[model samples]
Target: MTVTAEREPAQVATLDPAAIAREASPEALSGTSRTPALLIEHLSKRFVVGRKRKPVTAVHHVSIRIERGEIYGILGANGSGKSTLIRLVSTLLTLDEGRVAVFGHDIEREEMRVKRLINRVSVDAAFFKKLSPWENLVYAARLYGLEAGPAQREAVRILSRLGIKESRMSRPVEQMSRGMQQKVAIARALLTSPALLLLDEPTTGLDPRSKLDVQTFIEELRADHDATIVLTTHDLDEAERLCDRIALLNDGRVVAEGTAAELKTQVVRDHGGAATLENVFMTYTGRSLDEDVEEESDDAE
Candidate 1:
């Protein structure tokens, strides 16, 4: 399990669900009065490694903003700083420099308020092995200060929509497949109706069918709940299918940012006709997005 510092300065309590929904009203969302759901400025993170001590810059002066109700995708290879960025925004890691804000509240100054506005679901979602999915989600709900009755109902509803069977809700999470556990983690995050949802490789390690299920669930969440999402993934096809806009991150920096079609158009213009997203990624990052690390390892041996 990942661990970080436990204490931070307190801020105002989280806004009520009713208040958040009211702010997300169609009129509010359509008007200029709407505040951005997330704003990140000049973010950077570094890690120290080795006995001789070397500094590794995981993220370097990266900045982006996600509007309310938008699904923004970050596309990158392993160790390219996507997860590090998410952790910084979620306040799981203190920033080495720069700033992040959620719903106009500064993450550093208003940590609790920022925490309330967002929830993160990474590939390796932590859960109690002995607890059932329903029980785990209920526990999460309690932590978020939700009442038992409404929390239980919402958990069931979200999980069911994610293709989890009602019959399996009582089984221990350890017995469930990885995909199912992922769905449960997502459901737990949605139970609090967060304004900003950070999903770090949410579909990683899932079979095709399960990936589709999770993708569909994500679309529905944005449509029905007006949630803003920031997702990081190495799956270019999934990014093309699900993202409203994508940022291509390579070596801790954003090399390109545009809609999928826009990116493809740029590639075609630069590299002659018949250029695809794959070609675009190759041209910009000098690496194929489909090249698996395991395949490289096998070849090396």
Candidate 2:
């Protein structure tokens, strides 16, 4: 794989405000890419944890083609390479083999251009803990070349839509609950109007109601904006509800790929089981959906 970026990962990592600030452009914000939203071919990424230990193959040779405006989900157990795949596409991790393209622009050949077209939200988002939600979002908007006055107004609209009160906008993010902070992260990613949004375990820690709020907003974004979302989550119901198609990953490789209903029908026909995503997971991965969720850690997911 070619080195597509000259900068360090921190500059273009998830929620990369500094990188967005440096590379923002009017065309980037226009969201007018005519090609498929995302294309990946034989992608692979491995991590060298120690000299004595062999490399960990985090993402195997995975290939996927996502059409414009589709909501795609990468569903897997913990450490199943869900987040690793998202990181690879978001330009946070380098590829060991294969290629990724966003809107016909090759990620390696046109790194900066790709950066402008995409933004990422991870399970644990970072922020200026001391800064208010409005402050943090406006700062991100400025990085994306959006005008501050309009940016602030848009931020309010977004947070309010997410069920955050206007009164909470001025308080330090450190004071907010985990679910509220996650909502703020979603708002920040949307502030730039990214054409391709990468969400890694977006609802991992939220309560049921908060999860519902985020899921509803996600559906609305796909319906109302020029947004193609790639979501990585283990929530079976969430994937069945939000994703247009789902890919189940196991041990860093795709075990099954199809719409939720398709997968369920497949399992029932081939494996003799209930027609549900939960059954689909069990059929393919040889384990229950909730098995060992806490034992194996997903690296920096």
- What lDDT score belongs to each candidate, Candidate 1 first? 0.78, 0.80
* Candidate 1 lDDT, 1-301, residue by residue in tens: 1011222222211223464654333433444544567778998999999996999999998888767677888887777788999999989999998988777778998898777778889988689989998888889889988888899888888888888877998989999999888989998888887878899999988889889999998887666666678999878888888888888888888777887788878778776656577876777677776664565356558
- TM per prediction: 0.87, 0.86
After TM-score superposition, what is the CA distance of residue 81 in candidate 1 from its true location, in Å?
0.4
Candidate number achieving the greatest lDDT relative to the actual structure: 2
Q: Judge candidate 1 at residue 172 and give its lDDT.
A: 92
Report the number of the highest-TM-score candidate: 1
Enumerate clash totals for all models, in the order shown: 0, 0
After best superposition, candidate 2 residue 96: deviation in angstroms? Answer: 0.9
RMSD (Cα, Å) for all candidates, in order, is 7.4, 7.6
- Please report the TM-score between candidate 2 and the true structure: 0.86
lDDT of 2 by residue, 1-301 (tens): 1101121111112223354334444333334533456889999999988878889999899988776667888888877898889988888888899999876678888897888878888999689999998889889888877898987887788889999998999999999999999999999988787877999989987899999999999998876663578999888999999988889888888888888877888788887868889998887777887673654444445
Reference-based lDDT, residue 126, model 2? 85
Local distance difference test, candidate 2:
0.80
**TM-score computed on alpha carbons, candidate 1:** 0.87
